[model samples]
Target: MAAHFPINHHLRPLYRLLSALAGLYMLVFGVVGFVQTSGAEFFTRDEAEWVLGLRTNPAFSLLSLVAGVVVLGANLIGRNVAHHINQLAGVVLTVVGMFSLAVMQTEANVLAFSMVNVIVTFILAAVTGIASLYDRVGSLTAARAEEAHRHSARVA
Candidate 1:
């Protein structure tokens, strides 16, 4: 009898959920951007002011929408693309979110607000990235093990 942690530790599901949440949040954000780009203001003026500030650059808005959709795709479709690729994509999403914040900081009026968003985005990205990477590693390892087992069986 050895004291050993379970193979599927507490972190695995945590990561999956985190990645899922990251994707879900991005999906919502993207939808909002898309809506705004189409001249739809779904938010109260106060709330919109609190977040988006005054300017509505259609190009930046479109970028936000596109990025959100891409991040969501990375989280959901990573596993399908090869485990390593999925993990890398998660990391990419995290970096992109943070990078977008820096880009926002360059704006004339919304420096502080954009920085705040940057912080939030970075946190989500890191959490989801770690989880996604962990999942990818586990999946790849399992796949390799299964492949090895199949090879042995074939040789027998």
Candidate 2:
């Protein structure tokens, strides 16, 4: 859709790739979480162990699974839906990253790895945010053009 509005094709691929990867990441995480909760034992102790129980939160896990699926499905849809999906994904990642950082600091004894994840997730969030804006702008241009065409056709 943005093709008529001077889009950077280079950016589209990047956005789609990031969205897809993020989706895949969440999908895998959800499946793993489900499995882990259904009686698989992990040898962990204390703070980290305590937080492991938090992963069993039905709300968080379900949200993760649904968000991942919605994001991936949006990519596969038409332009308007894709734009909105990218926007939502960006917001989710940004907030989730910040929350993860806070949780890691407070809930775990050794937060080195968690901190790394937080940093990476934040970067992903930033990239998605920019991409979302670009896509939305492009879609807006396309929509206006379509509207103009419809008006002209009706008048003719």
Worst 10 residues of 2 by lDDT: 43-52
Off by over 4 Å in 2: 1-10, 40-60, 107-113, 137-156
Clashing pairs in 1: none
lDDT of 2 by residue, 35-88 (tens): 544343332223221122233333334455676787777766636576777777
Clashes of each: 0, 0
Please give each candidate's TM-score.
Answer: 0.53, 0.58
lDDT of each: 0.50, 0.57
Model 2, position 17: C-alpha lDDT score: 68
**Candidate no. 1 TM-score:** 0.53
Location of the lowest summed lDDT over 10 successive residues in candidate 1: 42-51
